[model samples]
Target: MKRYLFCEYKKTRRKYIFVMAVAITAVALCWGLYGKYNESALKSGWMMMLYQLPLLNTIFMPLLSIVVASRFAGIETSMMKQLCSVMPKQRLYDAKLIYSLSIILLSLLIQFVSVYIAGRCFGFSGRFPIELYALYFMFTIVPAVEIYVFQFSVSMLFKNQAVPFFIGAIGEFIGLFALFLPQYPWIRNSVIWGHYGALQFVGGDWDKVTRISTFYLMDINWVMFAVSILLCVAFYFIGRTLFVRKEV
Candidate 1:
């Protein structure tokens, strides 16, 4: 199993590094360049970047997931349908899920580093709160795995990649933007991850009867973490079910 995954890692590793580097470079340049307007612009850029970090998941994860899953699927697509059906069903299903998830974890490690670099460049005022960044990595990784497993299962559902890729793209776009609609607070709490990102730091600055009307919300911290875990479990089985029943 280790050998098989390592081989897949070798084949697909470039995409992870390339995508993460691009995201980090783009984020840094956007903030670094926009910082020239004024000191406030720089500060706002920093704050904005912090709030928008979760947006990275939506922007990069989907296409990355689709590309990785497609690569795995492409390899297995050549096998005869009967060959898969007659094999040890558990091992066959496990191989696909394991390969897809291993790549997802690798991509996530890159994202964690990239986001940390972006945070530092934005200029941390304090010790950079290792715990906060750790949670950021944890929360972000849950969704990354969800997107990867979901896309992998979707790819297996159809031989064609276009439809699954499109669906993943559309789903990610909606999930990223849900924070903007403050009126629909349920969406803000339940579906939107940026909500956690905001409360994580932005809470400190929420001025009462002043410029920033928002404040720290500690109410849903446990719930958000729980939901992320739930998503991981939910998608694992979902992908497993799809793969187990899928035709070769």
Candidate 2:
């Protein structure tokens, strides 16, 4: 397993996968932090950050996963026939899956640290809200896992990376719009891409006249969270089976 994982990294070491992941995270963070630090924003900066991040994550995380998965899948598809002759198909698939997930996990960690630094640097109000941040991390990572699994699966099955990328782009469009349907939570819950918005524990209510936003803790959708995990497991097994059974 270690050798295979290392081999997977070696295959893409020149591709600057980590660099791309970091760049995406940075862009999302910058976008979320944009806007004037007004009175209301200053008062509830931590919560504001939390509230706004999922909206950005809904679009950016899947995009990162799509690019990473497609790059890895492209690498595998080109060399799969030769690699299969000397290696077990399942191991190859597992190696790539594990490596790809590790990349995502690292990106998530970077995002967390970047947010924390931004909070400290900007002097956000209230305590650090470690518990809330923890919940945010869980909410973000779960949906991301599901998205990555589906993205990776499609990327692997179709040598044309465009198929999975187009699917991911469509999902992003739907998920971003689904955020406006908060009154109909089920609408967001219906799609894996929208789960980022669906599972968010922070919400913001803005007063149009005052031009101020109030951020508060919202109920976490535990049921949808659980469902996402189950779906991720299903996707993983289904993807692995297909890859293992495919004619190299």
Candidate 3:
């Protein structure tokens, strides 16, 4: 069972990494060639080069989650929950986390690098507040888990890659448009990247600007990450139970 799970998870992880690398690199190339339409920091009010990069996480991450989550479910369809029940709890949980985390981390890393490269090419304020970058690193972990938790949950519920992927797309669109509405500022509170202020880490609260740009959180990043982690764990176990208990 362990061997099978590892093989399947590894296969997906490999594909996820390869595809994301190519896609993000292409995105960086585009940024270097043509600014994000008129949204460039210079044209817009952004004083920073990094600001010129559209928040990729706002759109791409969820799309990736949906694509990968549906693929995860589609691939796992042949196996019943029994496979998980037979494995030790730790192994089962770890396998799932390793699979999801690899995807999350790789995508984040690629996006960060893409931004840096674009910044250098465009001469947008390539300067990021070191402290803000660090905080962005720390706080982003929660958003990553939130992405996976939803992916896994949605996959389990629909068991169709298209269903979850479509839902994710719709949600992404709505989430994007919602932030523009004055009445919907509260809705922005729930978005993962919505907390850009943390990215302003080096600037900190000493500067009012950091306070304005950082994503305000209802709870600390760690707490949010932990909660999402716990939920994913619970969802994995529940999925295993359902798979195992079913008459395969």
Order by TM-score, highest first: 2, 1, 3
TM-scores, one per candidate: 0.72, 0.97, 0.64
In order, candidate lDDTs are: 0.59, 0.88, 0.53
Report the C-alpha lDDT of model 3 over 181-236, residue by residue, as the tens digit. Answer: 53654554555434332222221112465423322223333444555456556766
Judging by TM-score against the true structure, name the best candidate.
2
Better lDDT candidate (1, 3): 1
Across residues 119-217, which tens digit of lDDT does each residue of candidate 2 receive?
888878778989888988988889999999999988888888899999999998888889988888777889889999989888788899998888778
Q: Model 1, 125: alpha-carbon shift in Å?
A: 3.0
Model 2: what TM-score?
Answer: 0.97
Relative to the true structure, candidate 1 has a C-alpha RMSD (angstroms) of 4.6
Which candidate order results from sorting by lDDT in descending order? Answer: 2, 1, 3
Candidate 1 pairs with clashing backbones: none
